[model samples]
Target: MARRDFPRRSDPERSPAPREREPGQTSFLGRWLRRLLVWGTALTLLAAMALAVAVFVTERSLPSYERMKSTQTGQTIVVRASDGSEIVTLGPSYGRWVPYERIPQTLKDAILSVEDRRFEDHWGVDPVGIARSVWVRIQYGQWRQGASTITQQLARNIFLNNSRTFDRKIREALLALAIERKFTKDQVLELYLNKVYFGGGAYGVDSAARKFFGHSGEQLSLAEASIIAGLVKAPSHYSPTADPDAAVKRAKTVLGTMVRANKLTPAESAAVDLKGVKFASEQGQNSARYFTDWVLPQLDLVLPDNDQPIEVWTTLEPAAQHAATDAIQANVPKGAQGALVSLDRDGAVLAMIGGTDYVTSNYNRAVNAVRQPGSAWKLFVYLAALEAGYTPDAKVKDEPVTIDGWSPRNSGGTYAGEIDVRSAFAYSKNTVAAQLGNEVGFGAVANMARRFGITTPINTMPAMVLGSSNVRVIDMVRAFAAVSAKGSAITPYGIRKITSTEGEVLYSHRPDPVQQLVPNYVAAGITDLLQSAVSIGTGRAAQIGRPVAGKTGTTSSNKDGWFLGFSSGITTGVWMGRDDARPVPGLQGGTAPARAFAAFMKIATAKRPPERFDTEVKLPQWQLEPDDESMQANPDGYFYADPDGNIIEPGAQGRTPSADSVVPSGEQGVPVPEGAPAAAGDDFLNRATGRQNEPPRPKPKPSQSPKPN
Candidate 1:
């Protein structure tokens, strides 16, 4: 058939089906796809293995488990008043590493019922809880339930950043597993309960129980335990002091949960009543808030370590503090504000009241407010005169005298012509003090005040002779205490002792007073003068039936009034005025302020015997022997005259003591009689330059210069 094929239709001129592809090229796309699939699978498997290793290592090496049973060294400071009552609390460290079994069952049940219900079953993770939390958040459009298991919360609190991130969550999950592996369920629960924050600066369930319920964690009833547990979520919001109603509501919710969880008996549920949550006022519970504040900064600087809590024994007397506060509130005249500070002679703070009400105004008038001290400032003037060897009975001219064009008049606008230093100080005579301040070097007075702990900057002006310089009651009180301490000036101290929780004393505060100012005799002299002032002087209102020394001060226009007094063992300073530096209509140092001082003193010393000055004091004898050249009166005893109609120059020997009185050693050379002028050769300048002559420079003005208000 092939011979004639050309003509046959079926014979097949076969174009030979399109050529088949080569073996390698036939399924190239399929091979490529298979290879890519295999490699992807292998890479994913390797990555998963690495992740597991990393997580396992992290879980095994969590730092918290290493420190799970560790305790922090807390400091407990005890502040005791002079009467031995606790008055201030510093950092107090209290922590006991208790095992889970020993922990109160109520505390455990309360915590479990409120914080995490499935705490025992979860292996550091709860998928159902996470899902439920997520759903709740989604439904509520806010973070409602955290879904954090006990382990998770512990992980976060112990060693995680306060943030919400996937990375943090992953880390938390890994750490939680490690914690569970390292500790028993009870241990983990115990640590969680003891380390959780319970607000009010309380860091654990025990502290929270004490602060909120005034009971120990071990002694908490079911209701109290539940309330404490509820505080873990939002302490501030549920704090009794912040919102007692909210706290009660939260407690009731916790109780309900406990009842549902079978942790509470039916009878317990019926008996549980959370309506009696008592909250202490957060403001000024210490009572010596001002004194405490003043002492803390100094304590921080002197404390051996800052991290540990300290027990500071203070000098505050609660009864005295209360009395001072009551007196301020009861006696402060209308339109007047005031401060009262009481301190031990050794500079220990006893009672400090800053204002009429500590809660309303925390301005700390005792330590912060600086107002003019009217006549109270006169003490430094008197002190300066005493230091210069002048007796308290030294005579000072009370007549008006112009110094540098400044005229000082007596406070009541009348002068006692001539007066002794004792009488001058008793009367609070501004003119006499001004003359004394000018007589002694003005700088001397300022220096003496500085040495006595008057820290406020003082100007060397004559007005400071009267209590014109501004001073704080605290500083003034401390200065006055120096006098009672027999010239020893001690820095004010409020802390007594600081200790560790283990009863190891960290520090003890003993007074560190120094004697750099006036001598004891000089202080005694000044104190005597002040005592006289209290007896019959301007400070009569402050008199107790005991020996006392003090000064009274009234600022210009009666804006500020002050009465500072001291007995043998205590010193107190009081100030009355408006905070705005405005005048208080009729307020004066001898009125309300003085009365308060007296009232407080009466109560403060009710149990103590009166104290006496510990030094011998004698009245000083004064003799003025004017030389012939310096005598003003003539032979007629009333007609001494010179070209200027003033006292003429008298020789040193021209003046003599009265024949009736025996002259002392230094005065024996005096010969001039009153109204007699010195002979030609007996020059007053020569007498001033002779053996009895004065120093090259005139004595500087008084020890303290007065400042204008």
Candidate 2:
């Protein structure tokens, strides 16, 4: 109260003036600013610590650069076709290492022009390229350009997989930086040239030059260099062997890029002869990979182990291999898989196709898969009958007959009452086959298959007369090859010779003493039966304007289809079915399998001289009998003959053998099942699905997302 009197009552509007702050003291506003400074300092320190930790983590996951710098796997296997052309490489294939100075300037410039223009100026990553790529991504909202330098690509190929992820990007950047710090510009370029993968299994610039241009990398011409450079962008899409037009176009783009980069003059670039870049006539063609894969595992058995690279000369004929590949690709059904094996009379494997494409599947189905030969199994059954002195003219009852427990049915419900052995075979009469099996004894038939070099376990079940036992595709090929070889026992072989990289012969195939499995007269009789079948029977679809003796087999419920035969001294066996052994609806051996055989045979036999099959055993008069009413009704309906005389036997073609052969009669509304399991007393080869001793198919690798080219 006294202070209020002494100090004149201050007006509410007039307050005491604020005192000035002391040297060490702060006003309320200053104190707030000091608190903000402390917080900002703490945040800065934390950010610094976080960056340090991130860098430490990234560096720890770096790839072993030292190991990648040198490419030496101790041993590599290079497979060559019969004509001395490379088919495939089993391990990493690197060309003789050439120093940076030895590499062609043209190749160097072309690579730099397309892959990385500032390769010499940048450390490991190009800041300008990264900035440009970022700008393009911003403008287009997609990754249309790549910022990876030559060093980055080298790191990626050597150390990491093609995984598109944020982690991969960071790892690539960090690794690129490390590569720049460790290697000189010339060393980096040399490593990039020596370690990059070219299309068609070529691993280095030198290998690619030799593979595509048939020359050394040091001798690469401008056009060849440009072609090789373009292939690095997208190997498969721009390979000259895969697509010549696309390769030429890509080469031209590389030349244009070179001109812009000042690495090449416009006139020089224009004068570059892209057409003059000649590639090896057959340089690891995609189809030949199957043959190479088959021959790879046999190296250990043929030659002693060594650290040097090996050169395996295989018996594979490139032309025949290509024909088989094209045939399977053209004729195989959408969901079905087909395998083919072709062998010469001497048991030399000429061609083998495991799947439609080697890139799609590498199961080696031709060598590893064991399936019921279907009616094709009749080869052994008939052989047993002939050995038992049954002539082709011998008559067998074709009327429906039931054995003790099972009765096998013909492909068609109706059958001729009385037919000769040849006619029965041609019509694929189930009753006659079962009777022959009983007459000859199932034990004899099993022994016959075993003598033919079939390694699969074969039991003496009466159903085996109709091909019930599982057999490997190569075994089927070998058995048929024996027929082509005049009934001589022989082992199917793909490797002809093996050599060391230093030009030393490691192994050379020497003919083994020929062993007779079946008598020549018996083989001739079997050939006559098979010939009649092809001439006017179920195998008519396999006719290729020349003598072709083969048998068709379709498993019960259409689970498998097969056509195994010999033409022009070449025995080729075809198997079509699902990998899971599931039934293929409407699939018959006379359909797609036979047609594929014909298509492949036409090309395979184009150069080989045609030879007549042994016809010592004459066919019965019934072999040439005219088509009955049922056959006439379904003449063109089964396997379908085109107007041009081409047999277009697809998976949906026939429900019966068709043509003049046994046909389904209207009276028998229920069609007979093929290769059905026969009861104890009666049987043809049941040919039920059996896959014994077959290696499991390899699981397909997951495909990486397509990246910007």
Best by lDDT: 2
State the lDDT of candidate 1 residue by residue for 1-82, as single tens digits. Answer: 4555456455467646788887767477888898889998998899778766766787677655436544343554545566
Q: Model 2: per-residue lDDT, tens digit, 42-106?
A: 99999767755655565465444455555454466778889987777666677556678999898
Highest TM-score against the true fold, candidate: 1
Cα lDDT of all candidates, in order?
0.72, 0.77
For candidate 2, report its TM-score.
0.59
| Model 2, position 399: C-alpha lDDT score | 83
**CA deviation > 4 Å runs, candidate 1:** 1-52, 59-61, 64-102, 131-146, 276-287, 308-313, 357-361, 393-398, 417-419, 500-504, 513-516, 618-709
Once model 2 is optimally superposed onto the true structure by TM-score, how far is the C-alpha of residue 624 displaced, in angstroms? 29
